[model samples]
Target: MYQYDAYDQQLVDERVAQFRDQTRRFLAGELPEDEFRALRLRNGLYVQRFAPMLRVAIPYGLIAAKQMRMLAHIARRYDKGYGHFTTRQNIQYNWPKLEEVPDILADLASVQMHAIQTSGNCIRNVTSDHLAGVARDELLDPRPYCELTRQWSTFHPEFNWLPRKFKIAFSASQSDRAAVRVHDIGVQIVRNETGELGYRIYVGGGLGRMPMIGPLIKPFLPELDLLSYLEAVLRVYNRLGRRDNIHRARIKILVKDIKPEKFAELVEAEWAQLREGELKLRHADIEAMRQRFDQFTYDPAAAQDRSYAKHLEQDSAFASFAKRNVLAHRVDGYAVLFVSLKSPSGVPGDISAEQMEVVADLAERYSFGEVRATHDQNLVLADVQHKDLYTVWKTLREHELATPNIGLLTDMICCPGLDFCSLANASSISVAQDINDRFDALDHLHDIGELKLKMSGCMNGCGHHTVGHIGILGVDKHGEEWYQVTLGGSAGNDASLGDRTGPSFSRADIAEAVERIIDVYLEARDSEEESFLACYRRIGMAPFKARLYAEEAVEAA
Candidate 1:
């Protein structure tokens, strides 16, 4: 919801102009395809297996209704009338022509959006909790910090051409909905005992060749010193992180080799030196940065002790929606509504142009004309009313947005594997559909309770399969589609990467394997309240492995 300042406006404007020139040269054959690929990728353009794909950053997954309208316009004017929301809280257009990208960037600039840092080896988009401003449990709204980092990292001279792409995420709330743990840098926003806002900084966490959880580089860094502390961490990483081998280039490899304690010591020494430098952000600047999140105007009339529960008591569909989709907002009257884009028999995060317009209209009409995209590949209305819950549900249902499957098995986070991605060996959308179709029984999924089934076609972990309660990764084995599974992974405060569960399954064997794993969970669980992750953790991998590998389970026992 942050509006772009003049400097922000000027920066994106200049970049867009520069990219236009680059694009013109590439089209004119002055630049070769390989040369253009690197240039364009740094600007968030990719040449997929078919056409070139352009990824547009939705910073921290926040979008205004006006921005949504802009996206719809982009879909209508440039793309194939739809946009695929990515797992990184970004949006991608798979069919973007190489020549049209600069024009697309121009349109995005008008809306205060861009693709900068959405790709490249430099610091990528700084993701945070999508429900930042609205989440009641948050220590502070994280967008200001994320925006600050965005400014500092964008075209940073030193780290601009790092060994590999670095991702950073901030989580301000009790829940780590942003999957901060799996990022290159994960900042857990916290308030000290003195009630001063600060960060618990984690460093060198990533997935790819080496999936390691970040270690706490700073247990508590004052909010004012966040930028300086971050600079220290990155400085250490840039100086020592490997460059000779692409596989060992990430900060994770450095963190692992240097040991977390030594890494922390180095960061501390660097911070001791530079903490007083020009980058030390002042309280006034923080407040100025904070003002942009003030776009939403609350309605006191829509406050609590309302009769909306009575309507839910009357209508079952509304009841289901109200129960599953709504979340607590910091404001008394406002509520956060998770509009499920992961509807039955649909793409996980693909919202059509009409759907986009409808949500945009709803946000403007009911909420505060503000929308958010979750890292979980869902849409959010950050300030819905308790009183207007049924009306919102009705509108969403009419637009086919009301799926009542938030946090359920069907609320899957998936990548556009094989369908759009050139690196993938198998189709993930079909795998997601198989699971959705099998558990189409909503009651059964609800009974299983809060199951996060994340899928990815490859080990890049875009879909965050490493952290899913039910993680499924697709691998190619001897030119055949094969699926690998992992369990007990979580991305919250107690974050840990899922361990691989051995032996890949055929495409035909995937659903059955999932069922077998679930069956083991059901049998081993202490109660229905115990989730798949909880059960798996409590009873180790032995039970689940037995069930998953059993001949009877493979043939449907």
Candidate 2:
């Protein structure tokens, strides 16, 4: 809902022009492959297994209806009629031609969007709670701060090329929907005892080779010093983070090696110099940034709808959809609807151009022309009136967007694994599809209840496998694709890395293994309310491990 001003427009236009020239040179053989690699990566273009993949950043996961339409247009014109939404709340085109990427970037620039910093050593997209302003239990809107951080880090001279890529996430709600704990920097908006707004800062949290839940570096940092404190933290990492080995280059590795206390000390020492610097966020600038976001206008008469209640009573399918897909909104008589991309047979996050246009139309008609992308790779219509919920559901169902499986096992977060990613050792999309097909029973999934299943093709943890209730990592074993499973991992406020199960399962047995793990959970759980993660935490890996290994032992015998 933040409109780009003339300055913002100018910056994006200039970058498009610059990248256009760079791309032309690279294609002309004037630029070396190594040099072009860095340039193209900075522009969010990756050469995949089959073709180039272009990742476009959706800052704070917010997109106007017009932007959505433009994205749909891009998909139709440039891509193969579809694009994939990613765990970072970005969109990706899997088969983009290198020569046409500049044209795509120009098209994106026209809509106040770009692929800049979506993939690079510089700070990536600044993500936040998808339900930022509209969540019923939100403490404060985190987007304003995310936007501020985006501006601060976009082309910051000191952090242009850090030792490794950086990510920052903000969550103001009690629920950690943004998975801030696994980010390079995690920001939690808080109010002090004196009722002044501030932040609880956590530094050096990340996944990949070393998964870590960032420690609380500063329990309370003043709101005015947000940027300065961030500068302090980044400065410490930028100077001290490892450059000798790419594997040990991330801030998390540095933090883990040096210890959180020492890292905190260093950050504090750096902050002491910048606490009063010009980088300090002033109230006036904050207010000006906040003004860019448009306030929603809710209808006073939309308190209740008898027809909606009737539909819920009569239609079991619609009832399930309404219950799972519709979330409570802060505004009275309104709801936030999750448009699930995880259809039973479809790819987890892939949306066709037609679906994009449908979502755009739905947003324009029902949600004030605004749409949001979630960290879980789903689209959200954040301002649907309760009265129109049934109509919205009908439209979504017609387009296969109403899956009614928001937090279920089928609603998984998966990466473009071996199918597209050249770096991948195994196929994440195939594994996800296999699991989805195996768990196609709606009643069974509902009975299993709120599960966060995540998968990655490799250890880069793009799908955030480290934090899923059920984490699956694809591995290469003797030229065969194998999967290693982990249990009890979570990305919430109480974040913890999952412990791996016994042995890797062959590609064929992976889905069955997942089913067995779920069966173990179902039988071991005290009640239906006990989720897979909670059950695993309560019983430990002994029971599940016994079940899986025993089955494997019997099969081997």
Kindly report which residue pairs in candidate 2 clash with one another: none
| CA RMSD, predictions in order | 1.8, 1.2
Query: TM-score for all predictions?
Result: 0.97, 0.98
Q: What is the alpha-carbon lDDT for the whole of candidate 1?
A: 0.86
How well is each residue in 317-372 modelled by candidate 1, as lDDT tens digits?
A: 78888778998889886778999989886899998889999999999988778888
Regions of model 1 farther than 4 Å from truth: 552-557
lDDT of each: 0.86, 0.91
Q: Lowest-scoring 10 consecutive residues by lDDT in candidate 1?
A: 548-557
Q: What does candidate 2's lDDT look like per residue over 1-557, in tens digits?
A: 88899999999999999999998898899999999999899999998989999999999999999999999999999989999999899999998888999999999999899999988789999999999999988997989999999999998999999999999999999998998888999999999899999999988788887899998889999899999999999999999988999999999999999999999999999999999889987899999999999987789877765777888999999999988899888987888999999998789999999999999999999999999999899999999988888999999999999999999999999998999999998999888888988899999999999999999999998999998999999999889998888998989988999999867888888898889889999999999888888889999999988888786432311
